[model samples]
Structures are given as structure tokens and as C-alpha cells.
Target chain A: MVIKVENLTKRYGDLIALDNFNLEVNHGEIFGLLGPNGSGKTTAINCILSLLKYDKGTVKIYNKPMAPDAYDIKEKIGLVMQNVAVFEELTVYENVDYFCGLYIKNKKLRLKLVEEAIDFVGISYYKDFYPKMLSGGLLRRLNIACGIAHQPKLIIFDEPTVAVDPQSRINILEGIQKLNKAGATIIYTSHYMEEVEQICTRIGIMDKGRIIAIGTKEELKDMISSGEKITVELFSMDNKILEDIKGLPHIVSAEYRDNSLIVRSSKGKNNLVSVLDYLKSNDIDFGRIYSEPPTLNDVFLEITGKELRD
Target chain B: MFLHNYIYRLKCIIRDKEFLFWTLLFPIILATLFNFAFSNITEAEKFTRLNIAVVDNEEFRQNTALQRAIKAAANSSGDKDQEGLFNIRYTSKEEGDKLLEDREIEGYIYLDNGIKLVVKESGLSQSIIKGFMDHFMQLSSTLETIIRKDPQSMERGILDKAEAAINYLKEVAPSKSSPDIVVNYFYNLIAMACMYGGFWGLKEVTVIQANLSSQGARINIAPIHKFKIFIVCVLAAVTVQLFEILLLLAYLALVLKISFGNQIGYIIFTCIVGTITGVTFGAFVASVVKKGEGVKIGILIGSSMTMSFLAGMMYDKMKYIISTKVPVIGYLNPANLITDCFYSLYYYGINTRFFINIGVLCVFIVFFSLCTYLILRRQKYASL
Candidate 1:
């Protein structure tokens, strides 16, 4: 294991943020910590980084105790927190250079790395612009560049894609995969289930400050009883028809909204056909339908019970 | 790591241009304005007369010596000789009283049994005139006795002096009475101006902390220690502040012809220390308070004003109140210390406890600095 967080616990006065949380991230794997809002994702990360004073925990990075002044250990780990941490005064290139300078002392080498980091984020045109002048996405890219420019062995990106446009989000995901390919152990956290499914090799889903389940995407799908979600767009969804569909044998649950009904069921068998037959018998006009296999959303819903957002 | 942090901090300061202007430039401009406004004479100008009023209720009118003194006052060459500087006018007792009440003259001298100076207040020019007249009375009395003793010509000596002066005034061009105190203010004036504001802690409170354009958030992270960052910033800020001090001082020296002192190194050192003290106090303030740009400004204005007030920078209208009631604040205020230090250096060739002043201010700087560093080190991104 490259990173070991053992029996981690933290509290704020009377409120408990994390409780006996244990996690291990091995080298050469994109590990994901998925959680809802206020589910101690940030708390755990902070404790691991020794940014917060955890009441009880032993965070071993590269198999040694972690403390703030442990510059040798801190040297190999990079953190891009949820908040953008670039200096508002510095231009894009300068921001990257400054942070990289913390680890890399050689000026010529640091300059090359800084330039590559800027270009890698597709923000070369904004290399001279100050952080205040850049748009939100551009600033986010700058934040990532600052964190990853030092080129640490282990990189932790906490919700790096939040509030970014789709194009930027795609670019960020691609960059993360590239960073992993370059032999960086990545710890990625996000509530976006599809993003986790798309990139994370193994995901740990947490709730109420505990990891309820951890496995590959397919393995997590196997863990959850609900295998697939069928969403039907309906022209007219009658109250009795919706009730009758819910009463159907293999149907798990049905929700009607925006002229659509979402039917979820365990047993990946074709329940959509049976539901469509019932809808036809009931003379309900429906639009297109989409059947997505059990995503991380299904895995999250199964373990947490409540929706991840609540 | 040090170089990285340094570059990053430099960048931050550069990006925040509005902050730079307010913190660095604003206080300087305000100080310059105060310097010029409070100055009695920023430049040399044409000579003017000292207005004096006389109300003599004596039955001693035919005193030729007194008449001669009065007439010759207009034509006397200089105040040092007690004959040339007064604009004398005689009025009735009631008229003098009314004129005093109406502020028509600075004061009036009444010569009865003894001389009495009647005015709203005693000022510098008034005291100088009072001394001159006292001497003139005795000199006239002396000259009168000498002439009386000769038994040759029955002439009062003052009458002869006055007649001769009046006759000379008709033939010769006038001369100015330049007082020694007025002409001798070139001593350590530069060091005093530069050393006071910074030593007083007004610049820090007013400029760096109060300028809202400089954000505190950008610095809390960035993988660098706060103290090193602080050192860089303080060094940078003081360098600018001391340069401004030097600029104003040079303008005064080269242009206004003001001199600080003979000991050039010590004078400049005093200014440098004062600048550092100001920058340190500013950093300390920034550490303690959040949302303090306005409060910092308030302190800046209030501090410079109060320091100037206590240091006798303006009219000494509140000297009685400041000296007696609030002796501690008035006597020990840094600007008072700085100004007095320079004054002592110039007058007595003494440097009073420069080490002590620096040590005391360093205590404040360290105490506040440690607190600020602890607070910054424990910074939080969220409200918690």
C-alpha cells in the first residue's frame, strides 16, 4: 500500500466528522472516495494530509508517519483542494513556477515543467494573465497546474471538475488519466457517479463518515441488488397506471415526472419490456426510453438508502 | 522553497495594484500634505513688520526718552538692538481693551508704574518683543542719566538715538531682523520628519492593513512558511517607505535647505528603524483583525494626527492639556521620542536611548508578529 489511513477519527466540538475510517490506496491505481455533501470526504483528506488535527489516526504515506513538517513526505504528495488555491496576484505561469519551486530547486528544469503544466491544461494562451483575470474554468485549470506542476508521485484531486464546463471537465478527466499513465498514484473524489465510473479503477463509497462499500465499478454493481435503471418518457402518465406499474411483479419502484417514469429493479433481466407491455395495455403514450446498467448511483443508493444528495 | 515562496509573494503584490497604491502611496501623499500644511514657512518670503500696540496711562507724557524710543522704533535696523521691528500705535485704555477683544492687534503694552502686556495669549513673537522693550527702557534711562550728568547739553539719550535712527531711515534702505531661532531650524529636520510617522505606528495601521485591495487569503496556502513571507513583505514595504522619507528629506534639504545633522549615518539609521517599526506594527495589526481596511485607515489618520499633536508638530494650543493630564501618552509617544531624539542630537549632540527605543518597539513587533504568525498558520478555508 502506498497510502495507509488507519482508524482515522475527527470531531468538531460536539459534531463528529469522521469515525474510525480506514482506507488503503495501492500504487498504480486511480482510487476514488465517493460521498454526498458533508459525508467527511474533505475531512478524511485533510486528516490524511495532516492539515487537520485528527483526534485518533495514523496516516502513513510511503509507509512512514505523516506530520506537517515532514517535508520529505510532503514532497511526494500533491493536493488540489476543493477550493481554488492559486495566488490571486501571480500570473498563470508564475503560480505554477512558485509551487513547483517548493520541490524543484533547479530553475531551468522548473521552468520547463511549469510551461508543460500550463500547456497540458490547455491554458497556454492565459500563461501571462493573472488569476483574477481568468474565468472560473481557467482559474480551475490554473489551480490544477499549480498542484501537479511539482509532479509528485501521489496526486489527490478533490472535486477538481466542480463548476467547470463540460469541455473543461472532459479535459481534466483526460489529464488525470494521463497523469496516472505517467506513474502517479491518483486519489480522486467526486459526487459525479459517471465520472467515477469512467476513470476510477476502484471506488470506495462512503456515507455518514464510513466507507460502506469499496470495489471495482463492475464489482460495486454486483454488490448492489438494483442492477439497472429504466427511464421512460411518457406523454400522459395516469395515476392509476403508475400505481398499477408499481404493482407489477419484477418492478422495484416507479417515479413519474416531466412526462417520464423511472423504473428501477434488481435482476438485470428485461423489466422494461414488461413495463412497456403494461403501459401499452393501459393506452399511455410514451416517448423515448433509456436503460442504463447499474452505475455508481445504484451502488450509492443501495448502501446509503437515501439519495446521495439529501 | 524560499525562492518559490518569494516569487509567489512578489507576484501577489504585483497583481494587486489597487492594494499597492493605497498601502504604499496613499499614506505618503497624506503625510506630505500634513508636512506642508503645518509648516509655518515652506519658503523664504519678503520681510514684514511686527504689529505692536501701546496704551500708556502714565502722567509721564513729556519723557523725551520715551518719545524718542517710540519714534525711532520704526527706523531701528534690527530687533536684536531693540530699535527697528515694531509697528507702534498709541490708543486709549478702553480702545486698547476693545482692540484686544476684537482681535485687531496681537497685544498692547501699558507703561504705568510697571509695564503690562495685554493680549489674548502669549506667543513666540510676543515674548521676543517683550524682552526687547524691557531692555530698551533701561538703555534709555541710562542714556538720559549720562546726558544729565554731562551738564553740557540738556538732551535725553533715547531722543538722540530716535532722532538719529529716523534721519538714517530717510537716507538708508531698510534691513530685516532675522531671529536666531527662525534661521537655525536646519538641524536634524530631515531625520525628524522621516523618523516620526514610522516610529509612531501610524503608517502600518493606515496603509498596509487598511488597504482592501490586498487580500489575506491568497497567502495562507502555497506551501511556504508565513514568517519568511512576512520578512520579505516588511523589507519591501520599508524600502519603499524609507525611500519616500529620503525623497521628502532630500527635497527639503536640496530645495527647502533644511538640514538634519552632522552625523549622516546615525540620522539615516534612525529613519530606517522608524520605517521598520511602522511596517512591523502594520503586520501585527493585519494579523489581529479581519475586515480591518477601514479601521486601519481610521487608525492611520488618527495616529499621524495624534503623533503630530503630541510631538508639537502643529500649534501648541493643547500643550497645557497634553503635558499635565495625559503625560504618559504625550511624553512617550514614538513621534515625540523621535522628534525629541533629533532635537537633542541637534542641540546638545546627544542621542537619547536609541537602543532602548528600538528594543521597546521590537518587543511590540515580536509580540504582535508572533500572534499574527500563529493566526495565519492556523488559517481555515471554510468558516469553521
Candidate 2:
């Protein structure tokens, strides 16, 4: 494992920020800690990074205990904090170079890596601009550049796209995927399920300082009692046909409203095909149809009994 | 790693116009204002002549030696518009008394059986007039002794010695010039400027504490020893602050023409120690106080200003009063220590007092720095 956290517990006064939070990220994978705000995602990351004091448990990186003085382990880990943490006084190039110089002592190689990191984040054109002079998206990019300039083996991104524009968010997600492909194990955290679903190799859904579920997208979706949702556009739907669809195997619920017939399946391989065959057999005229397997949001909603963003 | 941190820290501080304004421009502006405000007072003390009246009485007419001495004292030295020792107005006793009472003349000479100096009140002019009278009395008494002991040897050199004693007394009177009070303002200003280094120190603290800033959080997770970063950043802060103070000193000495005596090495030592103490104190405050950045900054500024106020930055006499009233606080206050260091340098030669001030500052630097290190050495924070 690149990063392993076991039974981590942290408290702030009377409130427990992280309760027995456990996480493990393997090498060459983007492990996503998906949660809403205040779900202890950042707390867990902070504890693992040795930036916070935990009341219980231990954090290990590369099979060694993590500590403030774990320079050898820390050298292989890059952290992009939840907040923009670049020096406002430094230009983009200087900020990246300064942070990169922290790990890579060789001046020539640090310069090369700094340039590459800036280019990777697509912020080379704004290299001369200070953080304050850049737009929020560009600033976020610079923040990422500074963190990853040294090209550490394990990169932890804590909600790096929180306030970024949509385009920048896409670029950031792609950059993270690129980093993973380039052999850096990634630990990504965000409240946005779609981003995690798009890039994360395995997902851990957390709520109230505990991981509710952890698996690949397919495995997580299977864990829930909901599967592909089939929506068919219908000019008219009979109540008898809706009843018949509900009686079909694995059809959790079937409803007809506003010229559309919707069918939700609990678990089945061909729920959509069965619904379509039934529709045709009954000679129901449909305009359009859509079958979407359960989304990470759906899995999160089913497991948590609340909206992912709520 | 140390070089990188120091260079980046230097860049961050130098590019911050706000820091430059407080550390550099503000002191220079205050020094200029002090120069203008105290110009007249300092010049008057240094060069202005006193006004006096002499009574026209039998004692004065018969005292030929006294009359000749007064005439010589009244003659101008022919320097650019500078007046003599006294602007004398010979008048009757009633007129002279009226002049003294009306405050037109500082004092007057009352020639009677024996000469009596008359003044309504005591001040620099009154003191100078009294000094002259005392000098004349001593000379006349000595002459009387010489004449009584050996009347023939009196012409050998007694008169010449009396003249020399009279000239010597002339330099001791109003012309002697009191210590310049305006330099106290400049001294206090340098003290305030050095304490302003606390801002840089506070910035260093906030930047290294993960709970205080995102930059701090980012730094804490870096693969470097926390103490190394702390030392490097603090050195950078001191370097920037010391440079700013040196510039302020240059502005005072070169541009404003303020004198700080000739002890250049000691003055530099005092400034360096003061800067380090200010910054170290700031780091200590930042470490101990778990408040937000704004509150920490407010505390630093409030404490620095309060200390500067007590050090007599606004009213020079307050420093003396505090020293006499609450002497412990006077020594404890870094601003007071810095001001006193400059004060000792300006007034006295390099002596025990100056070294004592410098030693106290070094103690402060070490004590507060150790406290800061003790508080900050552990990198793990309760929260972030």
C-alpha cells in the first residue's frame, strides 16, 4: 500500500472530527474519498499526512509509521491542500520552483521538474503572474503545480476542484488521471461524486467520519439495492401496464407520469431488455428511451439515505 | 533547503509593499516630522542669547573690575547675527526690577553694598546669570586674597588668570548648550521601527504553523525538518527587518542629519539585537496565542505600540518617568530597551550602560526565542 491509515481518531474539544477513520491507497491507483462537507475526509487526510494530532491509531506510508520527521516517506508524498496555499507574493514559476526545491535538491533537475509541473497544469503562460493576479481557476492550477512540481510517488489532492470553473475542473481531473498513469498513486477527495466517478479507480464513500462503502464503481453500484433506471417516453401509459411492469422480476417500482414510463430495478442483468420486451408485447408506443446504471450518487444516496451533496 | 527557504522568504517580504511601508517609509516620515517639529527648540537652546538689565547704582560705578567684566561679556563675538552673552539694558533699580517682573529681561544685576542677582523665576537664563555672578565673585575674592597676600605680585598674572577664568565661565553658561531633546524623538522612533519587525516575525510564525495558515499547512507536510525551516525563515525575517532598520538609520543620519554619536559598531549591535528580539517576541506571541491571524496581528501591533508609547515615542519625558516609576517594566519593554540603547549611545561614550542595554536585548532574544521554539518545535497541531 502507498498509504494506510488505521483506526484514526481525532477530536476537537467535544466534537469528534474523525472517528476510527481507516483508508488504504495502493500504488498506481486514484483512490477517491468521496464525501460531503464535514464528513471527516479532510480530517482523515490531515491525520495521514501527519499535519494533525490524532487521539488513536496509526498512519503508515510505504509500510513505515508516518511521523513529522518521516522525511524519507514524506519525500515521496505530495499534498495539495483543500485550500489554495501558494504564496501570494511569488510568481507562478517561482512558487512552483520554491516548493519543488523543497524535495528536489538538485537545482538543474528541480528547474526541469518545475517547468514540467507548470506545463502539466497548463499554467505556463501565466508563469510570471503572482497568485493574486491570476483568476481563481488559474490560481487553483498554480496550487496544483506547486504541490506536484517535485513529482512525488504519492499525491494527495484534497478537494482541489472545489471552486474551480467547469473547464478547469475537467483539466484538473485529467491532470490527476495523467499523474496516476505516470505512476503516482493518487488519493483524491471531493464532495463532487461525478469527478470521483470519472477518474477514481476505487471509491470510498464516507459519512460522519467513517467510510460507508469502498469499492470500484461497478462493485459499489452492485452493493446498493438499485440498478439501471429505465425511462421510456410514452404518449400514453395504461395503469394496467405499469402494474404489469411492477410485477416483473427485479423491478423495484414502476410509475407512469407526464407521458413517460419509469422503471427502477433492484438487481438484474437485463432489466431494461425485459421492460422493453414487455412494452412491445403490450404494443405501447414509446418516443425515446434511456437506461442508466446506478450512479455513484445513487449508491451514496441508497447507502447514506441522504443526497450526496446534502 | 535553508537557502531556498531564506530566498523565498526574502522575496515574499520584499515584494510586500505593506511591510516595506511600515518598516521603511513610516520611520523616515516620522523622523522628518520630528526634525521639523523640534528645529526651533533645538536651535534656540544652542544659539539664542539671554537678555538682562544692570542697575545704575554706586556699587556698580565704583566696582571697576565688575564693570569691565560686564562690558566684555556684553560684546558680541561677531558670528553671523549671533548675540553676546547678555543683551544688557542699563537702567535704574526700579526700571530693572520692572523689566525682570515683566519677563522682558530674564534677570537683572542689583548693585548695592554687595552685588545681588534678581530674577522673578529660575530657568536657563537665570541659571546662566547666576553662573556669571558666581564666577565674578570667586575671581574678585581671589584678587582680594592676592592683593592682601602680596600686592606687588598681583600684577604678575592674577588679572590674566581672572580673564581666563571669566572666558572659561562664559563657555559654561548659556553657551554650554543642554543635551538636544529632539534626538530623543529619533531614538524613540528607531525603537518603534525595530519593534515593527514584530510584524515580519509574526508572519514567519503564521507561515510555519499549520493551524494558522494554508501556507503553513502546506509547509508542515513538506519533507523537511520543522526547526530548519523555522531557523531559515526567522533569519530571513531578521535580515529583512535589519536591512529596513539600517535604511531608517541612514535616513536619520544622512537625510535628516540626526546624530547617533560615533560608536558605529555598538549602534549596529544594538539594532541587530533589537530586531532579533522584536521578531522573537512576535514568534513567541504567535506560538502561544491560538487565535486567528487578525487577532495575532492586532496583539502584535497593540503590544508594540503600547511598548513604544511607554518608551516615550510620543513624549520623551515619559521614558524617564517610567524608568523612575515602574523601573522593571522600563527594562522589560523591548521598545524601552532599544530607545535606551540609542539614548546611551548618543549621550555617553561606549560604557557599561550601553552594554547593559545590549545584554538585556540579547537576553530577550534568547529567552523569547527559546519560548517560541518550545511552543513551535512540535509540528503536529490539534487542528487545521
Query: Which structure among the candidates has the greatest lDDT?
Result: 2
The i-RMS of candidate 1 is 5.5
Error of 1 at B380 (Å): 10
lDDT of 2: 0.88
**Pairs with steric clashes in candidate 2:** none
lDDT of 1 by residue, A167-243 (tens): 88999999999999999999999888889889999999988788889999889889878856799888776678878
Candidate 1 A-chain TM?
Answer: 0.92
What is the Å distance of residue B258 in model 1 from its true position?
5.4
TM-scores for chain A over all candidates = 0.92, 0.93
Model 1: DockQ vs. true structure: 0.39
Which 10-residue window of candidate 1 chain B scores lowest in summed lDDT? B206-215
What's the CA error at residue B364 for candidate 2, in Å?
A: 0.7
lDDT of 2 by residue, B111-192 (tens): 7779999999988778999999998999789889988999886768777666754343344432122377788888889988
Cα error, residue A291 of model 2, in Å, equals 2.4
Q: Is the docking of candidate 1 incorrect, acceptable, medium or high quality?
A: acceptable
**Residue clash pairs of candidate 1:** B76-B84, B188-B260
DockQ of 2: 0.70
TM-score of 1: 0.76
